[model samples]
Target: MGRAPCCDKANVKKGPWSPEEDTKLKSYIEQHGTGGNWIALPQKIGIIHIHITHYYSSNPIYLSPPIISFSKQINFSISFFVFGLRMFISESGLKRCGKSCRLRWLNYLRPNIRHGGFSEEEDNIICSLYVSIGSRWSVIAAQLPGRTDNDIKNYWNTRLKKKLLGKHRKELQARNKGNGGILKQENSSSLLLQQNSAQQLHPCWPQIPVLPLSSPYTNQSPSFNDQDSIRKLLIKLGGRFSDDYQPILDGLNLQFPHGSNSLSSTQQIQEEQVHVGSSALGCMNSIGHNQVQFGQSNEYCAELVQGQGSFITTAIGEMVSSNDYSRRLLGGSLEFFYGEEMITDNKIMGACASSSCGQSTNWGETSSSLMYPSLVASNYEGVRQEMPRECAFQELSYPGAQ
Candidate 1:
């Protein structure tokens, strides 16, 4: 047989509490203490614990304005208007359990209660805690002052999860672009292989070499520039160079789930490396790898690394203007062909390298067609696995890292 209800179901009023009931509860509590037993407190006031017979999903029983004014007059602002309304509504003989009453008092009615607007530091702490300890919100809440376990739980459910998911989505999009969009909807492996082979025949751009942290060709000077290090750091951080660079960094960060899931194995890493290498090369026109150099100008590379100036447009424009002969031959500014926004400042002007630049770039398609659910699952696991190693030399820690 089922256990009986905690409170008397026949007598106690239930559902949303009206403003009048709230005022009565608040007034009595201020004048006289709860008398240690919450179960007996409702009857102490004139509010009767009558059973709620009718229920309406959209009913406006939570009328707050009149009660808010009454609360202000009594100086019961310590409870906060919303908190006082909910707390007394149940405990004031409206049908709610003693346990719920206690919870409301502790979580909402408490004097030191903190609510609304989690700071960035708070966000990071929450994310880090979540990463380290899954969803033990009570434990997480302890680290944050004035934050209740319920608040953290609700925040995580409603906001934080979506933020993480969005990060994963952007990473996946980057990887997909890096992978030549091979991760598109394909049922079978053979078709994927066939598409992969087809893509190989048409060389779009020169390869971006992934180099190790230390190289023997080092001119060991007192202050030597590490362009490779800077590039690796930027890419791994999802276009973020540092805290100040967040605005330009956009939807980028070094957030990848760790442990055995999608990207746990060495084979997967190698596959992703190969895919990104080829796909990054595929974004540009056929230029021999040695002939094409990115940011040959030390000044420009430094600016790019430091997140200074219109580094994106300048770096890319310089590379294309110097290396691509076909672009110069086309005889128009690069901005004319690819819009002002993409060009960044319109300061560096170069011609369209390919006659089919408009056709090949397909700017709208590249920017718009975002790959979603696939980026979130096992397929995205490799990104997580790879990112930690991308800047493995440096001590970088963020949420969702292994």
Candidate 2:
């Protein structure tokens, strides 16, 4: 079965309450309480209907219930109170429902209820409470005396909300236009930093392995001595010694320094420090502590001779000695690059002939300077088409390695 409604919907009045209805509702509630049942209060206020048993009068000869009694003073007050309520129902009488009666008494006709303009303090309080807890109008209403939740809610939706929004927009626009756009700059810079941080953390970005530029242990020359030395170093550096290291560096050898004497002990307790940039000017393997050995007789000279018409030469072409160019290549107070590019009669020809692209350090200047950097260039021209660091690997001969 469906829940029964409190009143008949068709017969009850709605919309604006009449003056007479307001006055009647106010007066009735003040004189006699709603008895905690607003649904019955409407009927009680409409007309007085005393049960024949509750009333007694018969020219001082009326029969009263033998056990029932009443004080004359108390009965008279009750009669007077209901006298106004006992009027007959008319078309012009109050005809509202139970809910309407309740609402009228509580929100409109209640004593001390304020319905005029809200104060600035009230607006501030409303805005603050709304920010903290959102549209809980009843809770907000409790904070302000004499204000109804319905009134505050309507005020916020209609006017107060728009006022706050306009104020916020103006503040943001002024902040942007004044002070050299400081806020925008900080936000943009912070965003850029976050982007860079994300890129650094990306999995696809290559992890740059840390090692001496002249690592010597390449894909071609991994040996046992090198593996053992690296393992000990890693242990000293505080990392786990994995049982699986054998699969990684088990076959590496440790190349000894050239001038070392006979072993003081059976096991090589100490290894020579690899001087990557000190005297190295060509391949790390090929260069020594005090000399560079990049000459015309290097492994790839013949390839260049076959590919290009000329062998590599100094910029001034045999005028300035090779040593001077070597110093410059070593960054002896000055680094060198292709100050001027090589030009040939045929565009297809490589700069293999002692000349090529203009002065550009971008080619091979890794973060750490190569020990045997550009001696290959000084020996011939200032770095021809072949990479100067190729001597370190000493793997392929130039001009499209065979």
* Candidate 2 residue lDDT tens string, 1-402: 998978888878889987656655665676566779888776666422222222233112112121222111121112322432322212123567888898888788888889859876677666544432235577567666788888898898777755744553354346446744444444443322332343355422211111122433222222224445555643432333222222222212223323322111211221211112221212211212111212111113223322232222211111111112222333221132222231121111222212111111111221001221133333334224443443222221111111
- What lDDT tens digits, residue by residue, belong to model 1 across residues 286-390? 111211222121121212221323222222323222222212222133333345553432211111111111112221111100111121223223423442332
Give the CA lDDT, 0 to 100, for residue 236 in model 1: 43
Mark the 10 consecutive residues where model 1 has the least summed lDDT. 274-283
Over 4 Å off, model 2: 47-93, 183-402
Pairs of colliding residues, candidate 1: 11-51, 12-50, 13-50, 13-95, 204-284, 204-285
**Please, what is the TM-score per model?**
0.34, 0.36
Residue 360 shift from truth in candidate 1, angstroms:
43
Model 1, residue 210: distance off in Å is 22
CA error at residue 80 for candidate 1, angstroms: 28
Which number leads on lDDT? 2
In order, the Cα lDDT scores of the candidates are 0.35, 0.37
Q: Candidate 1 has what TM-score?
A: 0.34
